[model samples]
Target: MTSPDSSAPLGVFDSGVGGLTVVRALRELLPNESIIYLGDTARVPYGSKSPDTIRRFSVEDTQFLVSHGVKAVVVACNTATAHALPVLQATFRVPIIGVLEPGVEATLAADSCERVGIIGTAGTIRSSAYQYALAMRKPDLQIHATATPLLVPFVEEGWTDHPALKSVLKEYLKPLLDKGMDTLVLGCTHYPLLIPVLKRMLGNKVRLVDSASTCAAHTQRMLEEKGLLRTVKSKPTLEIYLTDLAEQAEALAKRFLGTEFGKVKKATL
Candidate 1:
């Protein structure tokens, strides 16, 4: 692959609109850089897919981004990051950033607690990706992981304050709370949308570690290190593509970005 010029837009891909949270962070931190975002909405909730399928989808997504001449790619989906990051990095020429490491680093940095909790889709929690990452960094850390699969659908439906949300939150978090976890890692990108409710439920005693901002910070540092940082003052453009046409995606994206995207085109991949 030819070297990507600094002017090339950064590529961000997720299984669905959840990745927009990462895009939101990127826009805030790297305002001058343009972005191309891809959402595989047709086969979303990748939390249930097998590793092989996830890897294949991730490869195709990366290929799509590379075809657009992006300087780097961000695997904004937690399941994809957990399953396919190494393969994507080894195969792709440009820098590929995954949400896992940044989230893990932030989780550890938040507090020096041996009892740490993690919540994500069933696939993410079952894969033990966060657990392994944390153990590698601190072998003594006790991991309490739970799969809050319903939260993803709740977030997708824009049910931030639905009457049923609190009940589910309590059910999913009580175990970790009982374990006396001082830090909790929102393992899935969709989980960040529930931050306010999560904070209210977890309270101030438990620190929440969100990967969105940390991942953006990591991307900025990496781009700077590689001399690929965009510094031009031109208005940064954001182009979004999704595998399926979803009206909800646009609305959810606005929720993440705090502004409506100029366009949301349907795509096949």
Candidate 2:
């Protein structure tokens, strides 16, 4: 395998369009580094899948990105990261980073983060990846985690402002709020899109730690440490791919990526 140079694009993959949030963050933090994103839209919700299946899909996704000569791979999906990160790191030579550790670090770094609440998909919550990581770092921290399976579909459907979404958010967050959580960790990449709504509901008391931005920061540090940071001052590029393109794929991608969205191609693995 050819070693990726500094100019090589960074690879990011998710179970679906939600991963674009990480792409957006990376674009803001490291504008000179190009990126290639892959969304496994055909099997969109890896959240409900078994650990073995998630691991298998993640490996295929990494292989696709590595084949394209990415300097490193970012597992932008929380479910994939929780279940498959170890396998991916063990199997791949290129640097493989995930959203879980960055999110845990960010959560711990928050001011007065004693009582923490984590929200993500069923697979992520079930895996105990976030909870264990947090506990390992700070044994006394209080961590409450729950699966918010509905939010991803709601966001993908472009229903961020739907009244039902707010209701669901309230219902999903009530227990954590009642527990007096001072910091909320958006464990899934998709959860970043709901920051405004979350802030409004949780008010100024709860600090929100967005995994996308934290993961991007972690990626930047890893690149710099490895001497793979792109130093060119030219315009950075973004390429998007989806295993099964939905009619609303571009719209959803735009929602997650904001103004950094671009044309998305169809990918097969």
Candidate 3:
């Protein structure tokens, strides 16, 4: 039988430490719950992978979470959410949520069918996945997207605050700003690390819509609907796992999670 504490530890995964943003949001909203996070650091950028590859990687990631006894799984990568959510949910008995739908819904509520810019990794932009998703729901929206590969590596290198990053930010965001985008979707999970610079470059009118908070909201509501919110404990449990780069992963986690993870052990499934 599944333990009553089954829902206590919700699983969260990303291609890298960027998903810690999702974890941060979850902690604020679901304070007493337990969370299990996995970052596939060895394959740190899922954004450029083929759809088939992303699906397979997501399966392995979720399987790793299930092995840790989590009751829910959150696909915290936009690329994975764009391509792999269905298979992850189908294979797992527990609830599965992804970042894209929440982000899309957020985008839908933010602006009309005006120009919307999306900046992500080369794979995400190349996939044309976001454009397709929005087109189905809001066909009139003029979608413009770019592949900001440097942003990902710059972010990964912990250069979010560096002046070097600011220069790279301008180059990556110039086209989107030129397109007169009213709303910009940070379509890659790692892109949020660059949000501050992105906002500075795009100005107040360009609403930056990222998926972490909304994903947390959905996770919160789902837990409530299922009566899974932990009321007995005042603090939630936090369990972190990484596929590789145990030390660096923990170091990067500090920037995203805003606290020292101390140690992130390696795990395989």
Candidate 4:
């Protein structure tokens, strides 16, 4: 229950390799801080799971990180954040953060963002977490939310530039675009990988609020507030763990984490 040392690595978890995007952002924003990342590939796509199951899985994920003596835990999965963030925070003494609120905050912070559209996994959109958070802050904000369940698989398959992906994206975004959405919130961690394609389709007018970068910024502020920012000047380390290491995990990790990708260990949880 005591305060974790600033030198301890920051913990981050996702249902799969998608959370590596958040890790990539954190590395850029807080270069001095080390990170411990866990990808629950064994139970990938928490989006379709029940709230109770997601919560239980999330608790186990947090416990795995806490066992490693992390300073703070970042729930990098939108589905888990939507369903289990409160319980994780209450159960664990370490400062816990989620991608949901940061994404909402980033969306509202966009200039001239009147009509906002949010896209995420089925669980995230179904939970209405981003919609509710945005509404709570700006009651009059026009919001359109939908679950783009197919996008995740496409991204994982490394088909970002495939013609089929374009077709699917067009289909998924039509309703939101028709609603005159000026800004779009990529609610899931996996969605950032689709940004280049999304921008190509939506153009410069529709601002994209990426949860990965927003969450990293939020984490930096929280660490500052709690005096948990690492003071060491040496090169920071990154430890990658996965519940089930898929054959393509390394390539996928590279795709998500960019230059920060490294050896991924198999985690029991």
Candidate 5:
């Protein structure tokens, strides 16, 4: 593949706004790099969908990013990473980064107890991507994965600290806690919002691995390695687009971004 223009924007996408966490990280690490983010709000939960559907949506998302002159593509959604990463990489000339492998590596590096727990959407947990990656690296590693589908909606609603959210987290995490997992991988992009609650529930002893941070770090390294890192030190642009507008999406974007998003536009794809 041809080398990308260093000055081009990087593309990041998810089923919805959760991918902004990855954007948040990228902004901190690569402040000079422009970023284009797409939220497929029309179909917010790719986790429950079939692999074929996820692949189609991922292709469309990548196409939109490509049209915008993105230097590389970051699949910030765990469900999409689990199901459609390979296809995306194969079809696109630009470098493609996914959240799963980086998260798996981080979890393995942080855990000495050989026990890892993963919490994601149904599709992610069901894909066994983390389990297989960990097992391949260390055969004796023990993994327990659970699908916490409700947490996504809770986050989308900007209800990270709601009592109902805590109750749901408790119920969802009880099984992994019982399994004596020493490290918990926040397998969904939206999951980092619950870190405070997760820390309270899982305590200081259990490490929480955020896929968004890992993915961003990975993107930085990959870009530098490929000589695609932008060198200009000016203000980087951030453009947010959604396929369908949700009433709460703008509010959640403000909360996630820690600033007003100014305006959100609709995407044809």
Candidate 6:
């Protein structure tokens, strides 16, 4: 509950392994900055959960990171951002970021296009979070959305490109393609793990967007503005924690993180 410190690691959390997309982006954008990541594997797939449940889980996740002394926190889960971000920003002392705001900003900044498509989990789409944000940015923009709930489970299970994946992705994205969308936002963090398949399916005509990179960029800019940039003196380690330490979590997460690190030790809540 104190101010962000440049010397501290940035905290990133999501309902599950999907947050690695954000961590990967952070590593690329701010190589020197230390990072701490948490995956609530015990409560994976917040997309189907109730809003109050998402809020409670998000609060616990944020507190876990704050207690560990992170300078800033990023809520990488779209469901959490849709339901919990405002409360966290208002109550937390340090600067807090979420995929929703930055993602919307990035989507709106795309070349003036009329037709936009959004693909995410059922909860995210049902919340109408992206639609609302898009409306605020461009009231006249034509936005189409469909929930791709299975992709998260598939990605979480490390099934990025099984033969079944193409069919699943095609079915999930057909609505967007049918809407004549020139741009598509992968609104769920886990969706980025399937970017290669998505890009292939969506092709060059439809721009595929992942907010992780933009979110990381925004985090770096915020820290720079606050003079909270970290100077690395040695190998900065990334500490990970998970509510449930399933072996699959470790195996699959490494793929998204682009590394072979083992399972995160269970967090002490």
Top candidate when judged by TM-score against the true structure: 4
Candidate 6 global CA lDDT score: 0.86
Give the number of the best model, judged by lDDT: 4
Question: How displaced is residue 72 in candidate 3, in Å?
Answer: 0.8
Could you report the Cα RMSD, in angstroms, for every candidate shown?
A: 1.2, 1.4, 2.1, 1.1, 1.3, 1.6
> Cα miss at 15, model 6 (Å)?
0.6
> Alpha carbon lDDT of residue 238, candidate 4?
95
* Candidate 6 residue spans exceeding 4 A from truth: none
Better of 3 and 5 by TM-score: 5
Winner on TM-score between 2 and 3 is 2
What TM-scores do the predictions have?
0.96, 0.96, 0.91, 0.97, 0.96, 0.95
**Candidate 4 TM-score to native:** 0.97
The residue-by-residue lDDT of candidate 1 on 1-269, one tens digit each, is 46779988999999988898999999899889999999998888789888999999999999999998899999999999999999999999999999999999888875567799999887788878889999999998889999888998888777988779999888888999899989988988887888998887767898888989889999999999999998777888999998987777777878876677787887775
> Candidate 1 or 6, higher TM-score?
1
| lDDT by residue for model 4 (14-106), tens | 998899999999988999999999999998879999999999999999999999999999999999999999999899999999999898888
Q: Is candidate 2 or candidate 3 better by lDDT?
A: 2
Task: Write the residue-wise lDDT of candidate 3 on 1-269 in tens digits.
Answer: 56446346889999988999999888988777788899998887898788899889999999989887787889988888878887887788888888877887888986453888888777677777788888889988888988888887888787787888888777877887788888888887777777787777667888888878888898888888877777764556688888886666778888889777546778775
Runs off by more than 4 Å, candidate 5: none
| Ten contiguous residues minimizing lDDT sum, candidate 3 | 1-10
Writing each residue's lDDT as its tens digit, candidate 6 over 82-145 gives: 8999989987888899998888888877776789899888888988989999998798999999
lDDT of 5 by residue, 1-269 (tens): 56689989999999988889888988888888999999998987899998899999999999999999999999999999999999999999999999999998788775475788889999999888888888999899888989888998898777888899989988998998888888899999988889998888777879889998898889999998999999887778899999988778877877776666657989989
lDDT of model 5, residue 248:
80
Clashing pairs in 6: none
**lDDT values for all models:** 0.89, 0.92, 0.82, 0.92, 0.89, 0.86
